[model samples]
Target: MRTVTVEDVTIGEGLPKLIVPLVGQTSEELIKESEFISQLPCDIVEWRVDFYEKVLDFSIVSSFSKTIKKAIKKPLLITFRSKKEGGEKELPTEQYFQLYQEIIQNGQCDLLDIELFMPEKEVSETIALAHQKGIKVIMCNHEFHHTPSMEEILSRLQKMQDKNADICKLAVMPNTPEDVLTLLTATETMYREYADRPIITMSMGALGMVSRITGELTGSSATFGSAVKASAPGQIPIGELKEMIETLKLS
Candidate 1:
């Protein structure tokens, strides 16, 4: 798989990159959180803009993103997850597109995460715009309901790559041990067969924690870990996750 590099950090090269999501409701809160996260041992910091109270305001959102950009030395991933995708709030598709375009034009982040479920034309246009600006994209899909079969998982992942994503990411909720295995199986298959770019796959909640720890073994290039609070279900704490991945590397 090809690596996605932002600054000096390479996603597909070694151990899965540790990503910490910044969940703040206010600009002040985000600034404070940025300061705190800069001290953590994380390779990337994701700004969950859907959780920010002032995201609908263009000025506030733009300035706040720039502030956080200056505060962190590592790569910043900007994600405005929609409510349908298990995010905090909802916005119309036009609004979502405009907001993302604005961020890309302003160069606010190293990566912009666009959902795979979005309208096809819009997704392609935005991805083209992002690439023109030299911004990488992690085309994503979150199935908080249930993990699909291994076949479905592989198909969905291949579609993400086909859409010209710099990285393909999928997160699912698992109901049984087989569900976790399904996600892992899909991860390996996608990497071995379909992917031209690195992949990020996780089966969420406690039953799927194994997916988070086993990324390197299964060919995933990134894993999300919690800083102060987990932005997603089943995230292992950043400190513990770092220790686990590091130990695994040595062993």
Candidate 2:
């Protein structure tokens, strides 16, 4: 069976990378949204579960998981981002960890993304468990405030690598054009240094919009775009982003 390998999803390449938004706050709404998203030609659908009203309820999440899998044939990425990572919820760290473990154990997602700052031991355990269950772990870190220096950006990517992540994702907000340049440079450098592992690097915000769409040229394995409303700043609609990527290919 085909799977999302370290460097790419066997099914996700060549096709434009898709970013399905997670906007609904209720289970019914999310189910409806999942059905709606499934009709689109997205490469992946990410359930930003942090926005769900019943995020703490395992049963609700489990039900949503089954429904989403049934509704969408595309790869599903489940993420319950913590407040510290620019997410909406603020569950206790322990509770969040427990929820993450349960999702890995029971949720039917193809990929589970955990933040890099989670307790190291706990995070390692989660990665091991996910691998045991044939789920990919995407270790991610988001710096929503400002872009760090190239060196710092590279360090974060290395940290994710050390966590034995199937894919490494780093996002930062850029204050200046130079900052955006630094993020892309770091992405290129990491791709060259670790050509075996897939790395997703992007700059968020209006100033960094161009970087998000064009990262593929710099060796980024994937880029995110919104299908409905944007989850983050500078997210162009998926349809528009798809057209741009195609245009770039033809150029």
Candidate 3:
């Protein structure tokens, strides 16, 4: 698989990289969280803009991106996760595209997360803009209710790859053990057979937490961990998650 280097961190080349998410509601809270996360042992930090009180204002969101970048040493990954995908806020489709466009042009974040289900033209255009500005795109799809079939999982990932995304990510809420297995099976198949770029996959919630730590085996290039609070269910704390990844590291 191709590796994506953000600053000095090279994902997809070693143990799955740990990504800590900041879910603060205001600039002060996000800055405080960024300072704390900078002291933690993780490869990247994600600011979930949907949780921010001023996310709908493109200028304020761009300003916070700059502030958070200064507050953290780790590479920043900005995500304005849509409420359709279990996020805290919902943005109008046009506003959503505009927010990302502003951020890409502002050039503060090292990476950006774009939902895979957005309008095809807009998704491709935003990704291209990020690339032109030297930002890696993590094309993502979240199944918050239930896991899709292995074929469905692979199809989504394949579409991401075709879009020229630097990384492909999928998170599924597994209702049963079998659903977790389906997620892993799709990830492993993608990594071993089809993927030319890095991919991250997780079967979410307590029932499927095992999938988060087994990335080295299942071929996920990174895993999300929580610092102050988890943006998603089943996110292990960064400290424990780091230890777990190290313990399971393949020699």
Candidate 4:
């Protein structure tokens, strides 16, 4: 798979890149979180905009985006996840697209996370806009209910690739050990066979925590870690995650 280079971080090459999410609800909290994240040994920082109280105010959101970007000095991934996919807020479809457009035009973030299930035309347009501004797009799908069939998982990933996303990410909740295996099997298959770009796959929750640290073996390009609080279930603390990933490194 071809690697994606954001600043000096090259994903899809070595151990899965570590990504920490900032989910603060206020400007002060966000700034404090960013300061803390800046000191962590992480590869990328994601700003979960839905958690911010003032996220709907474009001017404030844009300003905070710039502040967070400057404070972190790492590749910034701005994501306003919708309520449908385990996010904090619910936005109208038009508003959702408009927010992304504004973000792309502002050029404050290094990457943007676009959901895989959004309308095809809007998703395509948003991705095009982000690319035009030199921002990488991470097309993501999250299934909080249960893991899908291996065929369904691969199909979702293939659709992400067809959308021209710089990176493809899938996060699902596994009900059993076999479900976790299904996720890993599909991820490896996609990486080995169909994928030409980086892909990140994980089975969330306690039952599938093993999937988080097994990225190297399964061909996932990046994994999420938590510094202060986890944005998703089963996110290991950054320090512990770092040590564990190092221990599992293939040399």
Candidate 5:
């Protein structure tokens, strides 16, 4: 198994973790969010670039990356989620992939998240390009409606692993407590079976909040929380999440 550190925060090896403040669309909003994130105890800071007003402009992203790197010393993960994966934007697939490649080559982000649903050729190329530049690739899948069967979840995880992803992340919507259970069960199963790459598993929405906070128990490498606002449906505030993680550690 390979372990990675972003800004001195080690991920994997059962480390309890925190990722604060999902960034918004506008540069001003991201700047404001960075101020708030600096006040929180977070391990990683993610910029959800899909929300940016000039998302297609590689130069704008490069400039924004410089500002974020200077403002927050934490490890950064840059993501431009497609509309198919529960994000707000709808860029053409080719353009989106090009932008992602450009950011990986020119931006300062430590990690880049590429959705798993992208065409296999494109996904492979993106992963290869990211690796060439020494950037970690997080191959992610998002299910906003409902959790799939444990078998299906494992299949997705394996696919990501086969693609040489440094991390495999899946976020599914849970309609009931049982749905949350399904996600955890799959996380544990994948961890035990694969035991190579790190995996991030979460269930979204109010009903799935527990899975987000306590997923480390089931082998999740990290969890997400809001510093300014949530990118997902059930993200708790950073302060509350920090308290919960502390309590969990003591217990």
Candidate 6:
């Protein structure tokens, strides 16, 4: 897989990148929290704006995101995960599309997360718009119930690559050890077979925590870590994640 540059950060070509999420309720809290997280070992920061109290207000979201951009030196990825995919709140599809469109037009973020489960047309338009503005698009799929077959997972990743996604990401919940193994297998298979840019894959929850720590061996290029709080199920703290990645490299 080739490296994708977002601002000064180059992903997929070095130690697996650690992405921390920002999930604050108010604008002031978000700004203060981002300032603190900026000093961590985070290579990328994702703003999970679905958790924000004023997410529906375009001005507030954009302003607060720009404030974070100024506060953090690492690359910023604006993400509004949908409620269907284990997000904090529900977002109607049309409203979701419009919000992302506006954000991409603003050009504040280095990357954007567009869920693959969204309507194809909506996803396509967002991808096209982001690419046109030179903003990297992270096409993502999240399945919190069960891990799909390796074939299905690979196919979904291939679809994201076909759609011109700069990165393809998938997170699934594992019910057993075999399910975690399946996720790792699918991640390696997808990166070997279909990945062109970069791939971020992990199985969520305690049983699947190993996936987050083993990305260097699994061919994944990035993993999530907690900053102020963990947005996902199996995120390790940023400090611990950094130490683990370093240990993995030395081993």
* lDDT comparison, 2 vs 5, better candidate: 5
When summed lDDT is taken over every stretch of 10 residues in candidate 6, the lowest stretch is 58-67
- RMSD values for the candidates in order, in angstroms, are 1.1, 2.7, 0.8, 0.7, 1.4, 1.2
Q: Pick the candidate with the highest lDDT.
A: 4
> Which digits, one per residue and each the tens of the lDDT, describe model 4 over residues 87-118?
99999999999888887887499889999999
Cα displacement (angstroms), candidate 1, residue 175, comes to: 0.4
Candidates sorted on TM-score, descending = 4, 3, 1, 6, 5, 2
Q: What does the lDDT read for residue 137 in candidate 3?
A: 97
User: TM-score of model 4 relative to the true fold?
Assistant: 0.99
Clashing pairs in 4: none
Tens digit of per-residue lDDT, candidate 1, span 1-251: 58999988998988999999999998788889999999999999999999999888866776678889899778999999999998998999999999898888764889999999899999999999999988999999999989998888888888998899999999999999998988999898888888888999999999999899888888899999999789999999999999998878734
Tens digits of per-residue lDDT, candidate 6, 162-214, equal 88889989999999899999999998877777677899999999999999988
Model 2 misplaced regions, further than 4 Å: 1-3, 6-16
Candidate 1: segments with Cα more than 4 A from true spot: none
True lDDT of residue 227, candidate 6: 84
1-251 in candidate 2: lDDT tens per residue?
Answer: 11255324452245436667666788778778888888875678888888889888976786678788778667888888889898889988788878877887777888888899889998998899999988898889999999999998888888898888888899999999999999998888887775457778889999999877775577676778887667878888877887887777633
Looking at model 2, the pairs that clash are none
Candidate 3 segments whose C-alpha is farther than 4 A from its true place: none
Worst 10 residues of 2 by lDDT: 1-10
What TM-score would every model get versus the actual structure? Answer: 0.98, 0.93, 0.98, 0.99, 0.95, 0.97
**TM-score-best of 1 and 4:** 4
> Alpha-carbon error at 33 in model 4, in Å?
0.4
